[model samples]
Target: MIFHGMTVRQKALDLLDSGANGADVARRLNVPRGTVSYWLHMERSKRNICPGTRTPSCHRCDGVGLAGADYVYLLGLYLGDGHISQPTQHRVPSMMITLDDCWPGIQDEAGAAIHKVFPDNATCRVRKPGCRNIKVYSKHLLCLFPQHGPRRKHEREIALEVWQQELVDANPWPFVRGLVHSDGCRIINWTTRMVGGVRKRYEYPRYWFTNVSDDIRQLYTDTLDKLGIKWTHCTRAGKEYNISVARRASVALMDAHVGPKY
Candidate 1:
C-alpha cells in the first residue's frame, strides 16, 4: 500500500494511464495531489506528450486568432533585431531581441509584447556587455515568424506573408513603433543662421531608421507611405542605409505615435 520515491511515481503514472485523474490517483496512493500532478506531468514529458503537441497552442497551427497588435509589434522587433534559435539542448526554439541597457522601458515593453503574443511561454532577460537580450522559448516560433531562416536577415530577402501584411495594415502605428524601438531613433540636427546681424542656432528634430537590408528598408518606407509619412533616403559615407523622416508633418506624426525610444 505504501510506495516510496520512483515506486510511488511509477504507481501514480500507472493510475493516470489507466484513466484515473490526479486527485483520484493521489487519494488511492495516499500521496499529495500536487505530488501526483507533478508525477503525471513528468511522465507526460517523458513520453513527449507536451502541451504544444497535445493541445495545439500555436495560433497558426491551431487556426486560432493571434494577438494581432502585440504580434505586429513583435514582428517589427523581430525584423529589426530579433533572432530565433533552436539549441540542441532545448526542446523548443527561442526568440531574442537585444536592446540597449539604457532603455529599460523599451526592454520592458518588448518583454510584455513577447508575453502577450505567446501567453503560454516563459520569457527571460540576459545581460551582455552593454545590452539586455529579452528571450522567449516556444515550439511555434518559426510558424509565427516565417521570416526566420538560416541566413542573417540582411543577407536574405525578408517579406511578410499575407496574414502578416494584413495585421501590419490594421495596426500600422504599433508596427512602426516596434521597428523604431528596435533600430530607429529620433535625433536633433542643428544649423547656424544669421538673423538680424546676430548668429542664431536652429534645431530640427527627425526620425532615422538605419538598416543594411534593402528589403527591410523598403518595408519600413512602404509602411510610412501608407501612413502618409514622407521619408527620404540618406546616404552616409557613400552608402544609402538610412531612412530619414524629416518633413514637418511626418516628424509631427512620428512624434505623436512612435516618439523617441524611452
Candidate 2:
C-alpha cells in the first residue's frame, strides 16, 4: 500500500478489476508499477474503509460551493490572462497564469489566489524567459471555467454563469480588483493649467484597465458600474480598449477595494 500519496487506492483497485494491467494502472495514476500490483492484490473494501485523504478544499474538484470572492477573483484573473489545457495522452489537466517577471507583487497575489481556490492541490511557480508562471493540475477546472475553450480571449465569447454573476453582484470588488491587477495599471496623471496668470502643474491618480477582448472589457466595465465606480472607456492602439477611473471620489473608492499590487 502506498501511504502519504495522492493515488486513490480504491480507484486503483477498480481500475485493476476492469482488466487494466498493473503497469497501465500505475501509468494512469503516475505511481510505481509495484505499488499498483501490491494494491491490486490487497483488500479493496478494507482500504476504502480506512479513510479518504481528500480534504474539504479538494471538494472543488466536483464543483461544490465554488462561488465567492476568491472564486470570482480567480475567474477574473483567468479571463483577463489565464489559460487552461486538457490532459494529453501523457499529461494531466492543468491551468496556468503567466505574469510579467518584473511584477513580483502580482505574482504573489496570483499564487495565493490559486492556492485559495484549489487548496487541496499544490501550485508551483515557474520562470520562463521573460515571464513567471503559476501552474496547477486539476481536472475539475474544466467544469468551473467552461469558457476555457479554444482560441484567445478576444476571439472567444466570455460569459459567466448565473451563480458567478450573483457572486460578483454580492462581492464585485475582488472580481474587479483581480481583473485590474492582472491587466490594468494605476498611475499618476499630470496636467498643466494656468492659475493666477501663472502656469502650474497638477498631478492626479488614475486606474486604467486595458484589454484586447471587447467582451472581457465589457465585463470589466459592467462590474465597475455595478460597484458604482465611475470609469470611462476609450479605444487604444490596435484592438485594445482602455477603461479609466480618474474621478477623485472614484479613485478613492477603487483605492479602498483595490490598491497597488505591491
Every model: Cα RMSD to truth:
4.5, 7.4
Tens-place lDDT digits, model 2, residues 130-239: 88888877756776677888888789788887867888898899889889878988899999999999999999999999888888988898988877889987666654
Task: Pull out the clashing pairs in model 2.
Answer: none
Off by over 4 Å in 2: 1-63, 238-240
Question: Which residue runs does candidate 1 get wrong by more than 4 Å?
Answer: 1-54
Per-model TM-score versus the true fold: 0.84, 0.77
The deviation in Å at residue 169 for candidate 2 is 1.3
Candidate 1 clashes: the total is 0
List of clashing residue pairs for candidate 1: none
Top model by lDDT, which number? 1
**Each candidate's lDDT (Cα)?**
0.88, 0.78
lDDT of 2: 0.78
